[model samples]
Target: MGFTGMEAQKDEDLVTDLTGIHHVGSYARIDNLINFENNSASQLLLVGQRRITIDDVHDSDNGPLRVSISAIETPLFDKKNQMIKAYSNEIVAALREIVKMNPLFKEHMQYYSQRIDIHNPYILADFAASVTTGDGEELQSVLEELDCESRLKKALELLTKEMELSRVQQSIKEQVEEKQRILEFIAVSKLLGKVQGRIICLVGPPGVGKTSIGKSIARSLNREFYRFSVGGLSDVAEIKGHRRTYIGAMPGKVIQCLKTTQSSNPLILIDEIDKLGRGYQGDPASALLELLDPSQNTSFVDHYLDVPVDLSRVLFVCTANVTDTIPGPLLDRMELIRLSGYDGPEKVAIANQYLVPKALEKSGLKEGSEHVPPTLSLTEGSIEDLVKRYCREAGVRNLEQHIEKIFRKVALEVVENLANTSHEDQHNFTISPDKLHKYVGQPRFTSYVYLERMYDKLQPGVVMGLAWTAMGGSSLYIETTTVQTKGGKGSLVTTGQMGSVMEESTKIAHTFARHKLEQVLEPDNAFFEADLHLHVPEGATPKDGPSAGCTMVTALLSLALDK
Candidate 1:
């Protein structure tokens, strides 16, 4: 029965027939293939143009017969060639999985493509090595291939041997610049006489380089810069951090400076130190003592950090318009440098070295123009006139502003002229003093008044006196004239906002004048019995101090001597 079933199944095998036709070019027979019921023996067969398979043959089955069977066409190509498309799809899937597992491979692939395009084998090797071992040896190997092995090795050797050399060079350069900057500060401080710090107190009439020199110092030192105007700073906490007990406790100016500079050793400028206010809370100047003192600043403690931070390395610089307002202890710790008013010669140099070039650039003058020469090509005579007449300040701050104004006017003319001419032929304009008035308008000062004021105004009972103040020394005229007598008894009248000391000096002068007159002209006569009056000019100015002592005496003597 099994043999019969197998034969029936083989007869219905269409796939077997087609496969047999492709493989052998003939049909196959099922009875010769296998016995299905016995289930042990199996066989394959070809009958004509068909194929067949069978299983389980037995002797009772009446010879071999087909049972279960299956068949398919034999492809004309080999199995390897037939599965090529499926194999390629599997390969693609595997590559995508690898990319997902390591994203760096994708980046490496892109880099490799670029490297191959450029024929940079070194870069390719380095990239590959970086991906694999993550070491720089591959990069070094690439360098060797590029013929840079010796140079790189030498550079690395030098770098190791002289690591501190570069640091020393930088330090030396910083020191040189610091010296130069301090010198400038010293000059200004000397002019002002006494100031707040070694960095120099640039105190003069406004517009001087008082603030600028500080900025210049920071630039010269290559340091991070910050400016806090203590013009009205009343709280000491503004400089020294508040205690940690307080909410929102923050670091003071010094700590903030340290954070900003990143380096402990930065040139810090405290501007307007003299302007710090004395308040009920505390004095900022007292707080500055810890920050500025070189001896005690090694372990400076901030309230916020509550840790001892080293601030000895930092260079503290301070500037002020007035030194008298600074605390005595704080002032004593500083090496005061004073900046005075710029003289004519100095102004000329500043103009030539700094201001002129700046002005020309600002005026839109071509960088390499030969025709449009420096406007400040003014002679020494003219520059001197400008200094004395136009820009008469203790410092060149106003002078800089005036120069800027001059350039602004020149810029308009330059623009207009360039607009009218071809670019190639636009280098024919020059600015002279004659054209100066046209651009800068009329001269702001008269040369005549400055020249005339230089000489002393000599008159009866008037003597020239030199007086020293924060503004420097100036020649003062002490004038004394007889006024109408009031009573027979000698009395003294004083003016010119005389201080108590100055008023006392006037009384002394009267006594001295009376004694001299009595001895020289009227022996045994009473000059003290007559009324006398003494005064100083500029009555609105409140003048005080003992420096006027000799002036008052000399004026009284001159009056009594009738010289």
Candidate 2:
């Protein structure tokens, strides 16, 4: 071996400079021993002033040889080894598949593949060292493998496990980042008052929990809730407040609401906002626009106090039966959330879960009481029957009222029968579908009753129609027939307290029917010559809108063609 910068250095100091390269020939007494099983290398070499170029070495000492410095270099496998040539392509292809599964590992995979030594039967173990950098006992077993193909298999298995762990870690990092981004977005939105500051308007039929939802929001936020109705509010001063100079001057409902709640940021529910009245005093609906607008409400000025009240933090929820009567400008500032009425199944569920229990409590009918006998049993079928037969309104207000009425009667009957009847005889008072009529009187409504009553009337000149009213949806019939009047030429007469829109609809229907039936009718037919009367049933009730125009046309056509 030839060494540079070796100026009579101590043997211990030479150990520090043992990392440099050197040339060692066959003649040199160099012994570098590496135990593949131990997973460690031992190198012993003798450095001299001159390089040794002899082809053979002659050593006489057989005793243990000691060296102060050491280094080891493992040799590559023979290129002519047939196994390496046969298996190289298969291992490369498998590595390519792994790289495709993890694109980020491509550079590392290439570097490790280039470092593989064909002489090392544990070429896979050497590659895995670069890949995993782990000295695990499992990897030690792979290092001890001596077979070319078997070691390659073990190395690939180790690489697969490391890749799976890497993928899982990467996935966890991405998920945490996504959650952080969402949290930041929500924080930013709330900080800027972009979503939370808008005034929300709940539009639905009566008793649909609009006001209740407002209270729920307040309770959830740990804020106070205040509700007031403006159904017939007319004076602008009621909202903006009367001036301090006026008699009995006071702050507007907004200030009153804040004072009642005793919090600046309390939730204020404005009920019946759609029914806000407009009179000579001024429009209350118009006054509400300034109070509801998030941008303007920050510095709301009340006339009575004549001071700007910071109402930006206050949450406003307005409730209305419908949005038609609400002022357009005021409505523009609100975010509308429409709640539809509960159907039969929903009402039955609510009655069973909440309404029935509330009624029992209110009517002094204690479930499981000696006089009441067992828990107040209201089956789902019976509730469904009640919902179908007694209450058909859009809202549950009527249903709740009917349940309360039934409970009141049951309470009364139980008290009277407490003295006269035995415990077994009390079963007569147990509420069921058949006995429902006895408590609430006859069902206020019956399913398809109107349609059944009008079945015979639905003839050649009559057509069934649907109409919506303040109460609920109902069936209507349009009847068309010839009306004889002396010297009266063909004319149209509409009854049923028809409004201007309905009158216009009747005229349009008559004109359209005449045009459509022109070819079908006889040339000498008196269908158009005689006066036609279009009469809607329930003549005393006022009706409007063009919804019934199709029914009117159908009835007119039926009468004209006698079909």
Candidate 3:
């Protein structure tokens, strides 16, 4: 032991925190650990001369250890001791499995692999734990365990779980790749014949990849892609083309789409067809009926094309946020498919398979040759954290934004480090939960309904409800609070930007609560004199659905019960 003295008062606090079971080790303590002179703390510069153990810890009159130092037993290792030898071999084998699962550990593991004393069970256990640093609690458990067998057993269990998890991740990656191949094949072999001269309308919530699917279809067919939005378009002349008699005549959008693509069989995507409206020029929706009709379009004549033009080879696809607004006759001409947003597991898989690699390339994180690990990476826990916390969306638009945000920060750090150093070290940032906030800012928000369910602590007059929208399903909370009026007369008040449907639902809920209170509560309870104000949060967002009816009734009953 060197530099034997620890700060007199703070020594016991540090003693309690010591987790290791080592019989011989040393650490120094300083009373007021910081210093004002030269703005540096005092250093405990100990020179190790020899190893020793404290045989006795006598408290004397000083209230601290005034001990005698002695030499203790050294662990003996014999290769012939099969029990000790077996545990030692198992630890090494488990460490190798862990290394195989995690590529990031491979580079640093070579040194530890060669340095570990395989013959000594205790030494092997310690070496394996250091290489596979599982977690604080697990590491501390291994540190305090004096038995070599127990230490090796614990380390093996931790490594086994890690290896199994890695296998699942690898399997998911392969499945995603195979799915991509199958989709491409289906596009070429079947979709070409299915929608040869027909139109397709993708109906889904915004950001649900409707537009991207259109582009993907075009790529799969090896055709040029062109898109134009007909939102609020209301002129028939735009579809049939302007007559040559007009001073400035032009071809219709269909002819222009064919001309710009230069390929007669190119894909044409019409965006927001449901948004078309009436205008003085003419009804564009009516003209679209003529263009999309299979019998008329084969030799379709445009006013400006001035001749029969064949449009049967030009494939048309359309997209809309909702299908209801599309004219019934127009919608009948196309095949429609709905794309709901992804679930949690699906989002995580997509992030790993498509989003992560794309973000790495887009942010230039793998730009230089020496960026050795290739791309900035996310730890498994971090990927789960990002999905659960930062990105709770119907679409991955916000998820991609957050991922891009993380990479942009990593890019800055890499550039700054390179400028400051000799460029000898590679900058590969592997993000985990602890370091997540350093890259992306705080998560935008925690969903109110999610928090309510997680805590499972609901106050009276609060009820959960399910809702359906063009986007998808969502859960909302309906809260009813009672207010006593001055005149002993009560009128119900409703908030939450509710449409007429919700307003009527609220009134129905109020009437039911009144009848229920009459049956349950005492006849003269003060609750009858109080006005009830019902509200749903996020009032700026309009909500109107019959799905919330049952919930409103539940909330009103809770308020009446005052439970």
- Candidate 3 wrong stretches, greater than 4 Å: 1-198, 219-224, 232-238, 245-248, 367-375, 423-428, 446-456, 485-490, 515-530
| Backbone clashes, each candidate | 26, 2, 0
Listed in order, each prediction's TM-score against the native is: 0.57, 0.62, 0.59
Of 1 and 3, the candidate ranking higher by TM-score: 3
Q: Write the per-residue lDDT of candidate 1 for residues 358-392, one digit (tens) a residue.
A: 87677665467744534424445555656766776
**lDDT of all predictions:** 0.58, 0.69, 0.71
User: Taking the tens digit of each residue's C-alpha lDDT, what string does model 2 give over 169-238?
Assistant: 4432333633243334335545875434446787777876667666655654446888889989889999
Whole-structure CA lDDT of model 1: 0.58
Q: Candidate 2 at 490: error in angstroms?
A: 2.8
RMSD of each: 29.3, 22.8, 28.5
Clashing residue pairs, backbone N/CA/C < 3 A, model 3: none
> Candidate 3 has what TM-score?
0.59
- The order of the candidates by lDDT, greatest first, is 3, 2, 1
- Considering lDDT, which of the candidate structures 1 and 2 is the better prediction for this target? 2
